[model samples]
Target: MLGLLTSIMRVFEIPMAFLQRILGIKHLAWVFLAPNLILFFLFAFLPVFLNVVYALTGGDQILLRDRAFVGADNFAVLASCDNYLDPNTCQKDLFWRAVHNTGWFIVLQVGFMIGFSLLTALVLNRDIRARGFFRSVFFFPVLLSPVVVALIWKWILQRHGLMNAGLDAIGLEPVLWMLEREWTFFWSVFLSIWAHMGFYTLILLAGLQAIPRDVYEAALMDAATPFRTFYRITLPLLMPTMLVVMVLALIKGVQTFDEVYAFSGGGPGSATTLLIQYVYETGFAGAPRLFGLASAASIMLALVLVVLTGLQLWATRKNADG
Candidate 1:
């Protein structure tokens, strides 16, 4: 292994030396970066281009060559709503329903998720016993596969699962968790927050630690109340990181699928069906899959993310300027 490694290095050494002479040291960074840039272009940018292409064309065909260019009919179909507030009034009622569900999910999940994450981060930041253990315990869920996390929660929340079993053991009536509209939606948001809060909490923890100790010392010296210090100092200083978390949480909320789909299967009556699942089922899961429509839906989702990112970036920039 050592000899082969040495031989390969020897082979590359000549060209590197030759290139160094031709390009100079300054340009060598680009030479080193070329492979990664090429791979990123091919794997990342190219697929995005293809997705846009697919969205413009129409067909049930898998291949771009087989699909026919249909302009904006797919967008038209989705946008053909009599009343934006009423999904049933729209031509694509399911799409609107998914959008409605996602809006509510974002409001509940992101708000509670951020609130809990910040609280956890604040507690972890304090000088408390076994702090490291507590931090690790909180973050452990983030290391698990989303599928695994969902499956674990599913086992806990199902009608005949651990939760119901425990209830029965306690002489309490077992409720249908997944079978009801309210409970399923509640769990979906709760489960999403539970699964992902640690990652954001970790970010907020880093931000919290990065705050200069001198500032807090100064606040203490001034006899500032804890709430006043937090409101006036901690919040302003932490706004940047908090904004970043908001962007991520919003994007995650919008594009959420896979684990959510597996957990609820959009079940009972599409109660938990989200936009991403709608796109997936439309594009891949059903017969005569409407690839163009799915692509359009995805592009709209991308636009939403772009808007969200821009809004936060503006907020970040404005905060810095102020």
Candidate 2:
């Protein structure tokens, strides 16, 4: 093992020595960085380039060469709608329906996520009984795979499952959890919040912990009430972290597919289907896979993510400046 290690080290050194001789010490950083740069270009940029190329072409075909250049037709199709408010009037009605559903999902999911995560953080930040255990219990769901979490909740909430069984024991009626549109959407939002709240709670908890103890002590000396203290001290101090959580929650909400898909298969008459689900179905799940249209949808999703990320950066910078 030692001899093999020595030989490997010598082999690396030979190239390093040759590179150093050719480029000199000033450019050595580029030599070391070249492999990582190459990998990033191949993995990240190349896929994006291909997606853009596909987006510009029209295709029932999968290959770039076989795909006819159709310019912006794919995007135009997506944008074609008689009434923007009524997605049912759109040419790509399913896609528009998905967009509308996703918009609502983001609104509800982000609202609940921020509210519950903040409450959890506030409660867990205090000196409480079994604080570590409580924190771990809250965070454990986050460790579960999204698919597993969805499946577990599906079992629990299904009519014949644990929740309904418990309701029956309590002399209550069994609710149709997965077979109704409203129930399906509600459960999807609830499951998403349950599965991921811990991560945001952890972020808020850290922010709470980082706050100077003296600030609170001074607030106490001033005889500030708990509500007043939170409003005047805690909230202002916690804004940056909360902003981070909001941005993350928004991005995650927009990208939601797996958990919702696994939970309800975007069913109950497509009420729970989000934009990502629509894109996936368009690209791969259809008989004649609409690759160009899917690529266009992907570009739109990418633009949304980019705008969100840019806003986050701008907000973070503004916070820093202040």
Candidate 3:
């Protein structure tokens, strides 16, 4: 066994040493990075570049060669509106409606997600009974696949599902969770938060635990109230983690699709139709595929995401350094 292992090592080691010598030690790092860089270029950078190319053209044609350059007409049409706030006034009303819904969705989702995640983290951080069990229970949702998460919530929220059954059992009126527009949108946000808040709570939990025990001890010694201690010591110390959480949550909120799509079907008169769903429906799902228009909308979405991505990267890097 020892001889065979040595033979195998020798068979593979010689070329690595030769390449290392040729590349030099410092430059050799790029050798290992080459595969990842190539994959990223092919899958990430290439797709983005192709999206830009597609956005500049117009046609139902899916092939790059067949698309005739329209040079921002899709964008122009999207922007053509008597009132920016009213989707009905826009040339591409669905795009605007999705944009409007996405704007509100992101604001509410990120704010409430952070608030709820922080609260969950705080509760989980306490030295209470079944703390570990509670932490696991809260975080379990985060591990479920997005489609699975959506389906679970869908079954729960359906008129004949667990939620309405509970309501009936409790002598309350059964409300339409997915049929009404407003209620559908409400579930979109609520389901999104329920699926994702656990991961953010874990982030905040680590932040909470990293605080110096003596700081809280001193606060207790000075007879600081719970709120005062949280406000004065805990919050200030947790700001770094909070910043990362907010940026990440914002990005996730913007990119939301699968769960909400499966949950609401982007229905109830397009009430829950998000920007991502718009892009998907335009490019592929809908008939006479508006590939160019979809590409344009996607580019716009990507631009916003690019900015948020930079912020998240900065926050994460800063957090690691601190």
Candidate 4:
């Protein structure tokens, strides 16, 4: 009876009391929400606004008052290129190279990432030997710190590292994995997939498990082949989860930085330098830091992410309608 009274009070008495107050119940929800709203305004939106301000201004000063307003000159400088095909012809070769590398990275990484994750999830979802152990084994990499993962791979891939030592034992040539442009890019993609595939696999595995066993049983009773059943029933049911995984993987691939930076340091002539790395280098890594250009690049990256998000939403709506 006491608990019931407390619930009743919560639902009616408190609300009615609030309504009777001069600072009324109409604004009470905002009163409760104001703390979080203020924090978001201060921490999230404020920095973005500052970044836009910085992008529109020029000169070496970090202070807003000291900076000169240069409009879109920074953007124009980024756009100044004889041919977009060749970074060599561009005024900002490094930025273009970073863009090119990031584009290829996202394409290759997201594609292989989806394929490998789906394969792992499918295998693990089945009745197999040491299934629990295998799932844990795959997921262990995802649990490790990104810095730790990068360092481990770096040690293995270095010139005088374990990989080279093993190659020598097998009478194979010591591959300079990080010293070449192609190898650096290849390793970046490879490392990213290896480290992150487990998370996507877990997502897919959950989706797979959520599927009713009766569906598969029905398909079997119908004398349906595994492939056909998977195509007709499983694929259709899994599309929603797959879409979520794809969008998440896409965003993660775009935001990739820590692993690539820690692993390769964007080495071998900017081969693996991503947009985030380029922004960091332009703004902080070098002397005479170009904050305006970095801000412009940051804005460009934001636009790419916005487009990707918009596409995901559209795809989701289409799938829902279908």
Clashes of each: 0, 0, 0, 0
Query: Which one wins by lDDT: 2 or 4?
Result: 2
Instruction: Decide which is better by lDDT, 3 or 4.
Output: 3
Model number with the top TM-score? 2
- Per-prediction TM-score: 0.91, 0.96, 0.93, 0.91
Error of 4 at 21 (Å): 2.1
lDDT of 3: 0.94
User: For candidate 2, what's the RMSD?
Assistant: 1.4
Q: How many backbone clashes can be found in candidate 4?
A: 0
Candidate 1 backbone collisions, by pair: none
At residue 51, candidate 4 shows an lDDT of 97
Candidate 2 lDDT at 227 equals 99
* Tens-digit lDDT track of model 1 for 4-53: 99999999999999999999999999998999999999999998899889
Per-model CA lDDT versus the true structure: 0.92, 0.94, 0.94, 0.91
After aligning candidate 4 to the native by TM-score, how far in Å is the CA of 310 from where it should be? 2.4
Q: Encode model 4's per-residue lDDT on 37-94: one tens digit a residue.
A: 9999999999999999999998877888999999999999998999988999999999
Model 2 — which ten-residue stretch has the worst lDDT?
Answer: 313-322
Task: Give per-residue lDDT, candidate 4, residue 217.
Answer: 93
Model 2 segments beyond 4 Å from truth? 1-7, 319-322
- Candidate 2, TM-score vs. the true structure? 0.96
